[model samples]
Target: MMNILKRVITVLLCLILIAVAVVYFYMKQPQFGALPEGVRLERIKKSPHYRDGKFRNLEEKPTIAEGYSLVGELWESLTKDYPRTAPKDSLPSVKTNLKTIPADRNVIVWFGHSSFFLQLDGVKILVDPVFSGKASPLPWGVKAYKGSDIYTAEDMPEIDYMLLSHDHYDHLDYETVKALQPKVKYVICGLGAGSHYQKWGYTGRQIIEKDWGDKQEVKPGFTIYTESTHHDGGRGFTSSQALWLSFFIQSPSMNIYYSGDGGYSTRFKKISEKYPSIDWAIMECGQYNKAWQSVHELPEEVAQATTELKAKNMLPVHHSKFTLAKHSWDEPLERISALSQSKNYRLATPMIGEVIRLDDPAQTFKQWWKAVK
Candidate 1:
C-alpha cells in the first residue's frame, strides 16, 4: 500500500509540473504582451486611478458582483443551453469603400463589438478596431459571428488616429493592429497601454499615452479628452494593470462621447456637466449580466446612463458580433429598443458597415437584428 501511494504521488507531481510548464510557455507568447516598465511604470504608479499595484475604477467596487465567481460562470456556460447566443446565419452587412468616402463627409461606421471608424471634418479616427475575427489570445476561441467580419486590415484607409480604449484582447487585438500599423499614423491609448504597442513595434513618437484627465489636440480643430470609466483592462494573466477610458471628442462642429466597456455610474453625470452638449453618445449596451453587473451595464442601465449624459443621440454597441456573454445575440437591442420609447435621446441602430451621417437628423435604420435568427 505504501509503494502504491508513492507511485501515485509521483505521477500527480509529474502532471503538475507539465501543467506549469505549459502555462509558463504559453504566457510567454507575444500576444500576451509586455507589462508596464521603466518610465511608463513610473507614470502609471503616479496616476490618481492607480494604487496598490493595480488600476481601479472611479466607483471602487468589485468587478464581478459578490454572488458571482469565474468558476460558477464557466460551469454555467458549459452546462446551460442558450439559443442564438451567436447567429446561425450570415448577418447582413453593407460594405463601403472607406478610402473612397468623400473627404468632406462627416460619418461613422461601426464594424461591430466596439470597433468603428469615424470621419469628421476631414480627420479620420478608428476606435478599438479588432478585425482579427477572434477576440481571444487563443486562435480558435471567441470567434467573430458569421458575416460580422466583413471588414479587414486591408479594407482600412489612411488612418489619422487609432484610439485604443484599453488592452483587453477584444478591444486591442494583436494581429489586427499589427496588420494595420502601416496605415495608422498615431495611436492614442491609456497609460501603460503603449507598452503593448511598443512590444508590437510601434514607435514611441507614434503612441500618445494619457491619464484619465489628460487632453490632446490631434488636429488643429479636433481634440480628444480622456475620461474615467468603470471598467478594468488587461490582456493576459494580469488584471487591471492599466487604465480603461471613455473618450470625449470635440471637433469644431461636433462633440461625441464613447463609453468604452464600462458600467453605469455617476461618472456619466459628471461628464455631462463638463460637456454640456454631447451631440452623440456611443455606449456599450451588451455582454451584461447580474453576475458581472458591476463591470458591464444592462440595457436599462445604458438608457439611464445616456439620459444622464444629456446625449442627443445614442448608438448602442458591443453586441451583435460576438457571444462574450450568455445572453441571446439580439437581446441587448431587443431590450434597449423596447426601453427607449419616450426617451429624450434618439436611438441610432445602424447596421454593420452602414454609414451614420453625423449631421443627418433623419437617418433611420431598420430593426436589422429582427430578421436574423
Candidate 2:
C-alpha cells in the first residue's frame, strides 16, 4: 500500500512541472512583449506617480470594486446569463477610401472600440489602433464583433503620428503595431509603453514616450499633452509598472480630448476647467461592470464626463468591437444616446469606416445599430 501511494505522488508532481514548463514557453512568445528596461525603466522611475515599483493612480482605489471578489465575478461572467453580448448578424459599415478623402477637410473615422483615425489640420493620426481582430495575446481571447473589422493596415495611408494610450492588449495590439510601423512616422505613448514597440523591432528614435503633464509639439501646427487617467497597465501577470494616460491634442484650428480609459473622478472636471473649449471629446463608454468600476467608466459616468469636459460634441467609443464586459453590446450606445438627448449634448454616432467632419457639429449619423438584431 505504501509503495502504490508513493508512485501516485511522484506522477502528480511530474504533471504539475510539465504544465508549468509549457506555460512558461508559451508566454515567451513576442505577443506577450517585454517589460520596460534600461533607459525606459530609468524614465519610468522618474515620474512622480511611480512609487514602490509601480505607478499609482491620483487617488487610492481598488482595481476590483469593494466587496467584490475577482474570482467570483469572473466565474459569474463565464457562467451567468449574459444577453445580447454580441450582435446577431454582421454589423453594417461604409468602407470610405481614406487616401482619397480631401486633405483640407478635418474628419474622424471610427473603426470601432478605442481605435479611430483623425485627420486634423492636414495631419493624419491613428489612436489605439487594434486591427488584428483579437484583443488579447492569445488568438482565442477577445475577438472583434462581426463586420466591425472592415478597416485594416492595408487600407491606411501614410500615418503622421500613432497614439497609444496604454499597454493593454486591446489598446496596444502587437500585430497591428508591426503592420503600421513602416507608415508611422512617430509613435506617441504613455511612459514606458514604447518598450513594446522596441521589442517589436521599432527604432528608438521613432518612438516618443511621455509622462503625465508633459507636452510635445509633434508638428508645426500640432501639439499633444499627456494628461492624467485613473487606470493601470500591464500585458501579462504584472500590473501598473508603466503609465496609462489620456490626451489633450491642440491643433491650429481645433482642440480634441481623448479619454483613454478610466472610471469617474474629479480629474475630468479639472481638465475641463483648464481647457474650457474642447471641440470634440472622444470618450470611452463601454466594457464597464460594477466589479471593475475603478478603471472603466459606466455609461452614465461617460455622459457626465462629457458635460464636465465642456466638449462641443461627444463621440462615444470603446464598445461595439469586443465583449470585454458582461453588458449587452448595444447598451453603451443606447444609454449614452438617450442621455445625450435629454441633456441636449451634441453626439456623433458615425458607423464603422464612416467619416464625420470634425468642424461640423451638426453632422448626424443613422441609428444603424437599432436595426441590427
Candidate 3:
C-alpha cells in the first residue's frame, strides 16, 4: 500500500512540473517574435487595468453589494435595458458603411462605458476602445453590460487618432491596440503607458505620451491637451506607476472635454479656467461606490463636474455598459438625467449607437433600463 501511494504522488509532481513549463514557454514565446520598431520589452511597476494613486488604498477588497451580485445584476439589466433598447436603425454601425464624416460637423457616438466615436473637422477619433465583453485580465470576470464586439479593428474606419484616458483595461485594451497599430495615425496616452504599446508593436512616432498641462497638435485645427485626473493605473502586479489624465479636445468649431475616470475634484473648475466655453463634456457617470468615491464620482457629482467646466452640453457615459461597481445597472443614467434637468444643463443622452450631431438640438432617449427590472 505504501509503494502504491508513493507512485501516485510521484506522478502528480511530474504533471505539475510539466504544466508550469508549458505556461512559462507560452508567455516567453510572444516576447521573442518580430515586433515593430521602437517596440521593446521592459518592466513597469504598474498596468493600465485599475485606478491607482497616492491616496489609492490598494489593500481594499470590494464587497459585492448585498442585493446585487454580478450574475444577478446581469439578469436584471438584460430584462430591463435590452428589451426596451431602441434600435438605432438610422445609424450604420459598420465601419465599411460609415458615411463621409461631415467636414465641418462634430458627431459623437457614445459606445457605452468611456468609449466614443468623435468626428471633428473631418478627423475621426476613437477613445478608450474596450469592445471586449469582460474587463478583466481573466476571461471569467465582470462582463460588459451588452454583448461584446459591436465593432473591431477591421470594422473601424480610417482612424486618424486614438485618445486614451489612462491605462485601465476598461480604457486601454491590449488586443485592440495590437490590432489597430498599423492603421492608427497617432496614439495619445497619458505618461508611462507608452511602454505597453511599444511591447505590443506601436512605434514612438505612433505613440505620444502627455503629462498634465501638456498639449499636442494632431493637425492645425485639432488639438489634444492632457489634464489631471485622480485615477491610478497598473495592470496586475504593480500599482500607481503609470500616469492618468483627462483630456480637452479642441477642434475648429467645438471644444470637448473628456473626464475619463476620476472622482469629483476641483479639476473641472481649473479646466474651465483654462478653456472657458466647452461645447460638450463627455464625463463618467457610473461604476461608483462610497469606498472609492474619490476615484469615481456619482451621477450628481458628474453634473457638478460639467457645470464646473462651463460646458454647454453634457453627455453622461461610463455607465449603461459595464458592471464595474455595485450600484443598480441603470441608476447612474437615471439619476444624471434628473440632475441635468435641475442643473439646467443640456444633457445629450443618446443610445449606444445613436449619433449626436454637434449642431442638432440636445435630446434624451427613453429610459430603456426600466424594462429590465
Cα-based TM-score, every candidate: 0.98, 0.98, 0.76
lDDT of 3 by residue, 239-349 (tens): 554568788999888899998888877778889999997988999888887656767888888988888888988888887666676676677877988888867568886
lDDT of 3 at 352: 68
**Model 1 Cα lDDT, one tens digit per residue, 1-373:** 9999999999999999999999899999888888999999998998988889998777788776898898998899889998878888888999988999998999999998899999998999999999989989986789999999999999999999999888898899999888988898999999999989899889988889989989999778789999988889887778888789899999998999999988788999999999999999999999999989988999989999999999999999999888899899999999999988879999999889999999999988899988888
Candidate 1: worst 10 consecutive residues by lDDT?
A: 56-65
RMSD values, in order shown? 1.1, 1.1, 6.5
Tell me the tens digit of each residue's lDDT in model 2 across 1-373.
Answer: 9999999999999999999998899989998778898978988888899998898998988889988998999899778999999998899998999999898999999999999999999899999999999998876788898999988998998999899888999899888999999999999888878888999988988899889898889678789999999988998888887689999999999999999999989998999988888999999999999889889999889999999898888899999999999999999999999889866468988889999999886677888999987
Record all residue pairs in model 1 with backbone atoms less than 3 Å apart, i.e. clashing.
none
The model with the greatest lDDT is: 1
lDDT, each prediction: 0.91, 0.90, 0.71
lDDT of model number 3: 0.71
Candidate 2 stretches with Cα past 4 Å from truth are none
User: Which residue ranges in model 1 land beyond 4 Å of their true spot?
Assistant: none
